[model samples]
Target chain A: MPRIDGPIAFRGGGFAPSDRTWAAVATLVGVVALWQAGASAGVIPTLFLPAPVSIARALWALTVSGELWKNLSVSLMRLAVGWIVGTVFGIGLGLAVGLWSVLRSPGMALVSALFPIPKIALVPLFIIWFGIGEGSKLVTLAFGVFFPTVIATAGGVDNVPRGLIRMGQSFGLSHTAIIRKIVLPAALPAILSGFRVTSSIAIVLLVAAEMIGAERGIGAFVLSAGNLYDTDNLLAGIVVLSVLGLLVSWVIGRLERALLGWR
Target chain B: MTDGLRLTVDGVGHRYGGLQVLHGISLTAEPGEVMVLVGPSGCGKSTLLGIMGGMLAPSEGAVRCAGDVPPDCLNALTYVFQDFSLLPWRTVAGNVALVLEDRLSRTACAARVAEVLALTGLTDFATAWPRQLSGGMRQRVGIARALAVRPACLLLDEPLSALDAQTRDLLLEEFASLITAAGTTTVYVTHNLAEAVRLGHQIVVLSRRPGQVRDVVRVDRPLAERRAADPDLMALEQRLWRMIRDDAAVAERERIDASD
Candidate 1:
């Protein structure tokens, strides 16, 4: 028999990774500090890339003058209307496509054909059709959000276990009851994850649509600031957009925790 | 106890696409009796169970249920699945309440859910999620959900096949008592010989693919009185093993040959 070495070297410790919130916070803080230090020493040009402190000052000025709320409110309204409209219609059509054979092929065909086309590229076309107003901007965001929401909802519905549905049927559950009780809850985790994606898409399209034609949104403000060589406000507007994304992500996380606590 | 329903599967056969899975199988689950279907893998016992429960339409014949359904019975035929099939999003009581929700008033639904949870010894875990439970506990939830409807008949498809041996043994004793207490006719499909001798009043053995009934063995002893270590049951288990041993071996070899 071969003698083994003391405590045979442990090799199985690592493939499992866990979240460290502190590490994420520390990394973000470290990068901002490094950028601020470089900007103060003139190692990085402030004209092109405004310092974090300068962006903060610009934001404060905008807040005091009430201009930030003016632009932000308009953008928030557009996001709310566009995303809600798109989501309602998307989930409806997605459920139809998932449940029925007649709609599955045609709906998926349309999604596959249109999902890859960039919504930014169609902004000019929407402006032409909807007359360069809120109509055009809302349409752009809604259109961008529609296809992915459809795909996500349909996929979620498709992935529900057939056994669960069969069990529901065996219990003599009504057709609508099976879909509402068994199908919906089973598909929820996927639909919630899809919300995460579509929310980010809505923000991106909001900015693009505003940059093209709107006069009051943050995207328009950022573009105007860039045109006037006001790097401070430009960076400030971008910061607001990033912060908005973070806020939306945090809301979705809370929604998942509440709805999927069983999982 | 509710009067058990008589489930008759008359000349039932089923084919999936181009393949015939079950051929000319006929059996009857009598009122208030356990009918155990035992066979080798690929014998389509699950398919037969599905057909018996009206979950699947057999290609050749029909299934009929004839008996007085209890006034409070929400569903006449209920299934306890091999995988438990409890919704992960619903609590233990909520899963039991699912079939009752549409049929009963809100208070009545809650009452029935509470009754089944207590019956299954799961009253303490009523608010727990399915994922939090062990395999045995999850299947208890499955059985509880089935019982919540006051089902006249139960179609259990290898309910203990997914559990470990110790859990299977423990649940086997519980299942015998549960079935006897409910007095509901049951059609249980499994490959385990011991389970057949232990729970089955009538054990129906089947041949391999395109399965047909090979033999029917009757045990006159009451389910609760039967023990796993009884000499009679052990002898019966050995007899059943001998009956299906050649078929199981041939089916296994066919699997290997097809894969090769």
Candidate 2:
């Protein structure tokens, strides 16, 4: 230290960055505006990629004709039923694998072996087994959703602090009580994050299954539009799918805020 | 008040696989007395505590509990952990209420939770989460949870060791009064000599690993009357430190060597 005449310069402030909601919204709006301008000036071929305004007009026409809800409702039902059934079974088995020594190794082994096989690849096999009906479509989505949920739940359970479990035992808590109260809440964050992954998987598998077979649904509508070379309707269908994803992620964000506010 | 339980450690010895940690440790914690276990870092005091609390099984010997249990005691023996194991997901009141839910009715449980929160001066922070608390406040929640059970015997595993010196000093005074008032037999494990001299009715000094009893110093003074700055207590603290100084140095060296 030579002299203490000057104030020290601060050097520890750049690594931490805060999120800006307005910046994200502005970027999306800017991209759409640029795309619309290019389409109007005929600088880009609308035949290949429809302008955002054309996609919006197609969506409006579909909504007015009731075709949007008609196909969307069917897809939503498949997504809900398949995702719920998969989640219930996955969570049950995951808890078993987490809590019991008898199941941990065998359960994890099966999950590791089966989780890597893409569910989209099983669509043709499912169609042959369950027929080209709702049965096959549902099975495809559920199968895709199941493995990830199990892995997430098990991983969550594994990460719960041992000291907390020991504290529960010391208090003479019953095995069921400990599992329900202590283990479940501790693992909820991981399970919730797993839900985020599984939900996306469910959606992707739903679209793929519908494209392979099925007479109605958003995926069927999109595929038929693409076959007819109707780029506007195809992009409209894609927009609907994107909105569905955003709505789902928004719901999960709310759920996290409500449940994990303590964090 | 109902008589606190007597906990007896009969020829207690523990080994972790090939490593011998504690050996031939026989001692009795008389009803309603504070029995402090003091030793070097690797002296297996916490292992011994776990064995006594029935959380871990010792390699040899047994622990026996005798004497009356209060009717309201939900758990006969409860532990206050070194890390203040409050559930991060639950509020302070909710964490305290965990042990009571299965045993008590809804209203009764709520009442007991309120009572303990008040006892620990945490009534204002009952709805706060553990992550929202300071280290000292978190341990207060731990103590509140332990007291909520109305335990016949309390097993505190270095409960104050995680706090800052000022907080530890402040909480130590509170601990003495609370223990004296409850008259619950306590087995407190720590390496702090000042804590042992201040709180222990019988302070058990242990040697290095393969820990055996080196000495048991008896303090006849009442806990409420004991002070940290008292000349007698200071002398007692110095004496206890002298007993463990060589063993502690050796244990520290062994730890560094093992790490290398």
Top-lDDT structure, candidate number: 2
Scanning candidate 1 chain A in windows of ten residues, the lowest lDDT window is A3-12
| Model 1 clashes, total count | 0
Estimate the TM-score for candidate 1: 0.97
- The DockQ assigned to candidate 2 is 0.91
lDDT of model 1 at position A242: 97
Q: What is the lDDT of residue B242 in candidate 1?
A: 97
- Candidate 2 chain B, poorest ten consecutive residues by summed lDDT: B1-10
State each candidate's clash count: 0, 0
> lDDT tens string, model 2, B60-141?
9999999998888889999999999889988999999998998999999999999999999999999998988999999999
Where does model 2 exceed 4 Å of error? Answer: A1-7
Reproduced native contacts, each prediction: 1.00, 0.97
Assess chain B of each prediction and give its TM-score. 0.97, 0.98
Q: Give the TM-score of candidate 2.
A: 0.98
Query: Clashes in model 1: which pairs?
Result: none
